[model samples]
Every structure is written in C-alpha cells, then in structure tokens.
Target: MRFDYSEFSGDQGFLSPDELFAPPNLMNFILQYGEQAMDAMANLEDEEEQAFIQQLIDAGLLEESTDEDGNRRLKMSPRLLRGLQHRALLEVFAEMKQGAKEGHSTREPGRTSERSDGTRPYRFGDPIGELDLPGSLQNAARRQVHRAVEEAREAGVEVPRGLRLPIGITPEDFQLHNTEGSADCATVMLIDLSGSMMRYGRFLQAKRVALGMSELIRGRFPLDTLQFVGFSSLAETLHERDLPLVMPKPVSIRDSQVRLRIPLEQAYANQEKIPLHFTNLQLGLRQARQILSRSGAANKQIFIVTDGQPTAHVTTHPATREDMLYLVYPPSDESSELTLREALRCQQRGIRIASFALMEDYWGMDWVGFIEKLTRLTRGTAFYCTSEDLASTVVESYLTGKKSKKFIH
Candidate 1:
C-alpha cells in the first residue's frame, strides 16, 4: 500500500471579496472576524466596492498603504483601532448589568475619592506622608498580642486580657492612607494560543478581550502595565497593535500521543520545524513573571485566558542548564505539574493570578480541575465560563483586581 500527500489548498473560490461580515463595524462583525474582514477587503480590486471604501474614508477610519510586495492595500487608521479597542471595553461595561449575578461582576473600581475610615498597609514604594497612627498602632498591638499569647501558651501561663497603649510601630505595621485610586499596577494577560482555542470562536473573544484590556489600561489605568503573552508549543509576547492580526495556531500534527524535546536555541532559529498548537502554559507564566519583575508598579497580577489544560511545557536541560521545549500530547501529568509550578512561582513573587477557563467542551473536566489546582496553589481566583461570558468575566476580573489591590500590598 502507498500513501499520497500534496500541498493543502483552501476553497476560497466561492467566497467573494465583497462578501464581508464586518465592514469596520466595532461590534459583532469586525471585532470577531478582523482577519476575514481585512482579507476580504484586500482581495477586492481598486475600483470594486467603491461605495464601501468611500464610506470608510468618509469616516476617517481607512487609509492607503503599500504591502511588502509594493502593492497598495487598505489600512486602518489609528483612530479606528482606538475606536475598536474602546468599544470592546464598553461592551463589557454594558454587559455588567445583564451578567452581574453570574459571579463575574466585581465591585466597581473608582467608587470613592478617599477612604477616611481605614488605612491600607504600606508597601515598599508607597508615598510617605501622615502615617495612619491609629492604624499603625492597631496593627502593632495585634502583632504584639499575638506573639504574647503564643509565648504564654508555650509556657503554660495565663494571658493578660488587657494590653497596654503606646504601641511602637514597626515597618510591617506601618499603614498608608487608603485612597480610591492610588496604587499603580502591572498586569500580564496570558492568552491561550492552543489549537483547542480555534473552536467555537474562542480565539476571537480572546482577541477582543486583549484589545479591550490594552485600551482599558491605556486610557483608564494609565500607570498600569499590560502585557499579552500567547502560549502554544512556545510562548511569545504580543503587542496591542498587532493583536487583531494574531490567531490561534492551527493544529499541524495529528498523533494519539506525542512527545518531543526541541532545543530552545534551535527552535528559535528555525521555528517552522516545530508544531505550534499545543498549550505550553508554563512558558507563558514564566514570561509574565519576568515582564512583571521589571515593572515598577506596587501591585502586580496575571490574568490567564485559556480553554484547555497544558499539553506542553519548557524545562531546563539538566546537562546544559539551558532552555528546552518539552512537548507532549493527551495532557500528561508532567506538563500540568510544570505549569502549576510556574504559577506557584508567580504567586510567590506577590503576583496575583486569575484564571478564566473557557468551558465550551463537554470534556472540560480535566482543564477545570487543573484550573482549580492552580487557584488553590496560588491562592488566586478562578472563573469558569464560556466564550460568550468572556467580556463580562474579564471586565469583572480586571475591576475586581484593581480595587482589591489596595489590600494586597
């Protein structure tokens, strides 16, 4: 018996260039199918769809640009990108009223000007001013009493019910005035680029969320840093401007079980040799941790949007003590273990983790369990939802984390 294979071809002949779903609309069509929208537009001839192109020009959202091949193509203005980004977030806010009871709507941030009743614990780089003397003394007194009670118990002595005043304040007990929006944050958003994400329009929702988050951080949380890391067989940093063009890697290999170890240097040199559809969350979290370490923000957090458990991870080769990619299929326990270890490392660095698990599959139990274990180990939050719930869930997580960060430091 002989097997034959040839270059795969897509059936685009029936698809017309003017048969576009989204014509620069910020809502359902463009945000969900940006690549198709662009491709459809690019395929049209110069004289074709003149009215539609004119409309885009009239709206000041479209411009002309030359491709690498020196051919002219339609380009979207920064204004259009800004509009799409802002609209994504606005849609989330709009969903808040409808989905708050779903356990995703967080306490809205910027609720009040200042917290007069309490003082938050001081962090290393907090602004120094009138220290909350009462709050400081209270923390000091609590610590002292706790130590005293422990000592008394160990020595079999009765503890004094009343404690003395004039509690000396230590650095640990120092508290800063609680302000509504005082703390700066560094946020890393890890988006799954696994092949599983290609189903049920999952990647579209993820892209929309990333864009919204990028804009939300830029416009609302100016001091906060937002990084998007996409993970598959490898992890790579994604920028906001290039997000729309990004898509989940199509499954390139089909095997019941797979195991491969590729040298990191070699993989980087010739990336086309390796498959890019397996989830490698350990590398994603590691990238996020490194990016956050460089940020000067007082509060750091990671938001992971993924649809499946990790199937691949990177490990340092014992002999070389250098980076290497460990790929596996059927989601080996080893892969999950390595990913969870990285999550733990993130938590140990005072970074909060929030996992948004997209459960569109009936066979989602394995991934949900992994998410549960991750949250447990990191002392973080987990949200189980579908792609439809992603916008509100992401918004709630972002707002919830932002407001609650006041207590973290």
Candidate 2:
C-alpha cells in the first residue's frame, strides 16, 4: 500500500481541500485505518502506489520495515506528524479569517480596547473612545430607513421611493473596535486520555488541537512556552515527537471482560499493554502546576481538553496505622472535590485554567455545572463546543487569554 499527496491536493478527488486540511480527518485515516484500506481508497495501481510509497520514504514522511514474519508495513515518521500539525494550524487560522469577515469577533476580554479592524455592537459601560463613528452613522442610517418602511406599512400609507429620513444615533447603534494582539505566554495543555475520550472520539480532537497549538506557538509566538501533557490514570508529559505514537484504549464490554479475566500476576507482567480507563484530573493539574512553576514567563496558563467529569483522583487511605496513596475510581464526590482543590491551588500560584468541555448537554449528570464551577473557582473561563470546533476554540481561547492581561492593566 502507498500514500499519495495528490489525494490531498485540490484537484478533482474524493476529499475536498478543506477536508484534507482538517487535522481530525487526516489523523484518523493515518492512525485508525490500515494500510490496505488507505491504498484502496487512494485508488492507484500497484506500480503507482509503490512509487508513491517510495516517494514518501524519500521525503522522510514514512518509514518501511518488515516484521519477523517478513510482512512489510509503513509507519508514520515524526516529520509527517509535524507536517500535519502545521496544516491544522493553517486551516484554523484560515477559518478565523473567514469568520472575521462575517462579523464574528473573537470572544477575548478587552478585545475592543486593542485596535480597529472592524466594529461590533456596543454595550452599556463600553468606553466611548473605542467607538467607530463611521460605522455607527451607517448603522443609524439603515435603522432610519427600516423604521420609515415599517411605519408606512403600519399606517396604511404609501412609502415614497428613495425617501430619506434623519439619521438618529442611539446607544443601540454604537460600535466597538476589535483587533488581535500577542504576548509572551507559558501554556500547558492537558489532554484527557481516559476510556471515555476514545469512546466519543474526543481524544482525536484533543490531539489535533495540541498539534495545532504547538505549531502556532512555534511559528507565531517563538518566545512563548508550550507543553503537552496526557492524563488518564495519571499524567505524563509528552514531547512533540511522542504525540503521534500515543493512542488511548477504547472502552468496550469485551475489553472489560478480558481485563477482568487477566490474572493479577499476568496483568502486572503485561502492564505496558494496558491503557488507563479513568480520569485523574488531580494528577494532571499537579503535573501542569509543576511545569508552569519552573517557567519564568510572566504569563502562565493551562488549557484542559476533556469531554466528561472527573472520574478519578489521588488520595491517601489509612493502612496499618499508616497513610497509603490510593487512586479513587468511578468518580465520587471526593474525586471531584479533590480535583477542584488542585485547580484552586494552581490558581493561587497565579496559574489560570481555560477548560474546553467537548460535550453539549450540561444537564446530563450536571457536568456543565461541574465544569462551570471548576473554571469559576480558578478565575478562568469555560467553553462548550463540539469536535468540529475544538481546534479553533482552543487556539482562540489561548489568544484571547494571552491578550487579556496586556489590555486589562
């Protein structure tokens, strides 16, 4: 089986350019699908496919090796993972540009005080110095014409063509300025790698966001510090080179039964093969705090990407009149409270938490309120989004938070 760059090119093909640039789709095909399926989807003849495969090897995007059984397979090279990350960042910035033209300003605090590339509806207490006079006048003129038409229709009077009315500028017609800014920041991104992330495909989205953020920081904010941490039963710091190799274990009844059947001896012997199935948010936060504490950057923050509530925590239990560390599983109030306590500890150390909740329904199990309270206690913010918007949301939140401190003071 071979890989073809043409498949992702913007020609008449099975995948559109937008879809090809999307990190989730590209990473899914490379990670989840087998080589044979990818070859079949590429639809190239054997000779063409083999040539493309050779090209990929020559370009250092893939490496070919044979197993002990003499079966050959292709594996992703670190270069390819880095390339995918760059592509994801480009796609996100492109989408942001499109959204800006459509009047969708970033939700960053104090954004209106930065500069004027566009205008937005003014609210009460907004500074008058930031108002866009031309835009406000145009809005008032449009409103006057609209009101005249509505009045004519209501009074049963004929509305004269090309009628003009005095324009009235009201507070409702006021506009505010918007702009983008940059700051030196240190960010630790914590991705949930528990069983639920795999079940709902949240893991894939989180990976894409991490990669995009890495690229964004490297290219745009060269002085910024960015770190990636994956957490399930525990938190482990991952470098950019280790990202593509990390895979979460899927949740399934069969897998659970198999795990249950494993003898304790054998399970301990094969510990490396087992994947973490519970969320240990406390450990993740602790690790993040440690990383940030070592950084000298004045602006430090944490971005947590998860789809559910905290399901595990670290605690000490009394054993033989001694305290022993224990992991609490299946999510209890104790776990949730411990997680919040850790977040507060981080907050006290001047670390801010920006949480992205991938699920939409907050009412289910009260997960929404849980996330809100978590962010609120940390003096940060929470965002509810879908997989489609995960990368953009993460990037924008970072940007918003980055600029907020600069303008607030």
lDDT of 1 by residue, 19-124 (tens): 2212335335555566666666756666757666766756666676788998757666776777677777776777664534322122332222344445677778
Residue lDDT tens for model 2, 43-161: 44589767866776775766677679775666667667767777667767765534333222335545432475566788887778888899898888888888889999999999856
What lDDT is obtained when candidate 2 is compared to the true structure?
A: 0.68
Q: lDDT per prediction?
A: 0.76, 0.68
Cα RMSD to the true fold for all candidates: 15.1, 13.3
The total number of steric clashes, by the backbone 3 Å criterion, in model 2 comes to 0
TM-score of each model, in listed order: 0.72, 0.63
| Runs in model 1 lying further than 4 Å from the true structure | 1-30, 46-48, 57-59, 98-112, 115-181, 402-409
**Model 1 TM-score, all chains together:** 0.72
| Model 2 TM-score on a 0 to 1 scale | 0.63
